[model samples]
Target chain A: MLGDCRDWHDVSVIEVQELTKTFGTVRAVDGVSFTARPGEVTGFLGPNGAGKTTTLRMMLGLVAPTSGRALINGRRYVDLERPVVEVGAALEATGFNPGRSARDHLRVACTAAGLPTRRADEALETTGLKEAADRRVLGFSLGMRQRLALAEAILGEPRVLILDEPANGLDPAGIRWLRDFLRHLADIGCTVLVSSHVLAEVEQVADHVVIVARGRVLRDAPLAELVRGGELKVGTRQPEQLRRALEEAGATVRFEDDRLWVSGVDAEQVGRAALDAGAVLTELVEERSGLEHVFLELTRAEMGEAG
Target chain B: MIRLIQAELLKIRSTRMWLGMLGLSVGFALMGLVFYIALAGVEMDGREALPPVTDPDTVRAFYANASGGVLFMMILGIVGITGEYRHGTITQAFLVTPRRGRVLAAKLVSYFLFGLAFGLVTVLATVAVALPALAIRGGSTSLLDNDVPMILGGTVLAMGLYALVGLGLGALIRNQIAAILVAIGWVQLVEAIVTVALPQVGQWLPAGAVRAITRTTGGFGGMGELDTLPPWGGTLVLVGYGLVFAVIAMVTAVRRDIG
Candidate 1:
């Protein structure tokens, strides 16, 4: 099974093509389309109610598409010969019976997927829930339940993982562990599509990002491209003068928060432009437009358009 | 499909709810047996007097009525499916078996077995109570030597069929509280009223079919008057109801979105 992980990309791609889902009068997912490739962590970024869960559900065939379809491995999820062995998913953290033990929970999934029951113990060990395996979920904290869900997801040792808001109840340490765990899965060539409303949770681990808001894909690109586009900030006593110099240097400059927002230029150019402008510089730094900034800009723009 | 059924059975086994329900089912069976034995030969209003245990029909009725505890089995089946929706485990179930029909079929099969088990246990419990009480009351123990075994088998089969019906109802009505209320209400209140008011119609209902299996003539809920179909006809009608409900449940389960 481990050896089979290497070449999964040939057949394990999660392809959503013009997928749309409408609930009554509400278009919950509006022609959303994206592919989560194997051997990479695809961060499904969205705010709450952004149709992230709905799209994932459609891909897993838990929800029917109103007009379009989502295919896994060039076949619909329902058409998969062995769905669990090929695609493992944790759609939510709370799909567990309160009275069931964590181990029993995974075992049930394992049994359903035709996997050995011992895989339940293996999954528990992988998710750091081994010690609490015998404990009923009724007494488990939210973090524990989240871990149990992950354990259930990995029961089949699937090559593809789709998790929806998997870090909802984790503490900081648990979140860090999850980050490393996902990275490890992707490193081992599993296609990981994890959705999170929190940008920072996905920022450290995701190789690619698919950002959605209001039932539409706002942006889908490499994480590095989404986060880094060379925007610089130059704070000076003469903001107008620095802005004019930076604009002359062929950079888009905006005056905001007592600073010159320079884009389309490097830090070195900004420093030189400021020096030539005869402006006394107070602060000069490359403004790293992290995922947080990009996400806000995209979602806020979406909100503006909607309004 | 077999794996899915095993998974469903494992789910029921993992929870304490089924064990508690099984205990309650046996208790109800014991209670009904005691009541039947105590009331033997006594006359009740609006009906024939309770026949003595020596009568073959009376003995068969005693064995069949013991499966009245099978009501808990029906509830078990309802909770089995509805609990998945209640806890959001239907998502997990569907994810594991993307062909939603397979999952529904698996649930129907597993719950059917559970219903059989419940019926079997209740019958055994009732027999344990009936044999001693009958011997003490000077009733012939030879009653078990007659069609008793056949009646017990039919009662167990009826219980399993009832479970399928319950599973179908639960799948159709995903809400646990609402489904349970419908099961109890239809079996207890509505069926009883119909059996009393319209015997012909009651004879075709699920409880009437079950009574026919046990060769019990009086209407469902042990009230009113009904002329039941023959045993084979009862089996066919119950199977028909189960299949109809199972099909409806399967189609709905496949079509509806998992919210």
Candidate 2:
């Protein structure tokens, strides 16, 4: 029943079907299933120890599942003839040898995959690591290591990319560069799956999200849908009157940072309320519900220090 | 398979271990040459007539006194895989080549050649020492001896076999320092104590088998703590140790999750 060959939108780069992993009595991943389709930056979101890494490992065939399967390109990863060219993965940022230079590290990957040695230099350029290519990884900053890992992951120019916590050690500027790079990757039809615990990090890059908690998926929905319910942020000179006015207008208002967060109301409604209340309005904007808020709400009950 | 081997070679090409092993083998042999040259005729233990190794059976017996330091090949083998685990790079290695059986096989084969190369270098150093020492002691070099080729070949094979055993140990024990300690303890203390206490059983063990493999130049003398198997038998036994480790690794590695 795999007949949707021509429809690129219907194709899945990653599909995990009822994947479960047990360590003794502890079930790390309990029948988890999710899909990451092509041409989208899908964020695999979960709290710490929420089976995210385990599931990714299982997908890449690094960890065996207790039951069920994880498939990439309609086949198991082990069955892939040229895994590097088809699936580029960077599970850990610091997986390169410390003694080897960054260029040498990528060369090893290129050599193993039988890709041209030139691809190593191309990858170095892609990750903006060309200046530090000759330096050994021992001296690399965490951000530099993450970049090297990205370079190695993209060495084979793979169609699908799987990265786990790709931005754990980046500065603000580096994070911005990463967001743009991943967006560009997805724009060019390369499926990108990046797993992260932080919401603000993924919210800016992820087009789709699969959030998990306590070894179970809490939601598998588009980012826009998950963060649909938001508040109208109002910055006013008179916070008390704006809050009272917004409240009188059947809106729930909370004071935050010299502004009234008007929930159950739109930006236009907040502006009209401020004008009607004769309060000076400086800034009024609709603040969408952040993935962090949605994530916390969905996972609060399940996050009882279980793991 | 060739690419995998090349990749494995690249992993260790710049490590200090290879240079250290080279220095170890050559240094030990140089020290032996110095000792034999200066004191070949000096009275020791009050036996004026007998030299340190008079008319010894094989070159390794000489190297046993000079430098059997190639015994470190097994340790090198352990570090090969364990180092990957220690540095958390096995994840990348496996990701690039997901069929772990292929990776394991490639490791063993690649490391076997790696071990063999060092084995030859160790022998070359030993010979370099022997050439001068023999001339100084008024003795003929054993390079042209008919048995030299087989003994040297066996010595190299012995080294390669130790590497296989080391690879197995690394697989069974993923921790680098722990695996290294076990390897050292096994080769130095355990085997020595066992050969001394139980010669019959120890001869069938790997260390005893190594004697047969390395001392096949005509007679047994070097690392000869116990009565050893024939050269061919020792080859099989030494190889058996590597195969046993590989068999155990093959069964256990896939069961546990890689990092």
Model 2 lDDT tens row, A249-302: 889888877777778777778888889889999988876546778898888967
Per-candidate chain B TM: 0.90, 0.86
Show the lowest summed lDDT stretch of 10 residues, model 2 chain B: B216-225
For each candidate, the alpha-carbon lDDT, in order, equals 0.83, 0.80
Q: What value does DockQ give for candidate 1? A: 0.81
Score chain A of each prediction against the true chain A by TM-score and list the results. 0.90, 0.86
Best by TM-score: 1
Cα lDDT tens digits for candidate 2, B31-113: 75455456555676775422443454423345443226545777788888888888888887888888888778888898888
Question: Which docking class does model 2 fall in?
Answer: medium
RMSD of each candidate? Answer: 3.0, 3.6
lDDT tens per residue, model 1, A30-146? 989888887899999999999998999888888888978888768899999988888888888779999999888888888888798899999899889999999989999989888
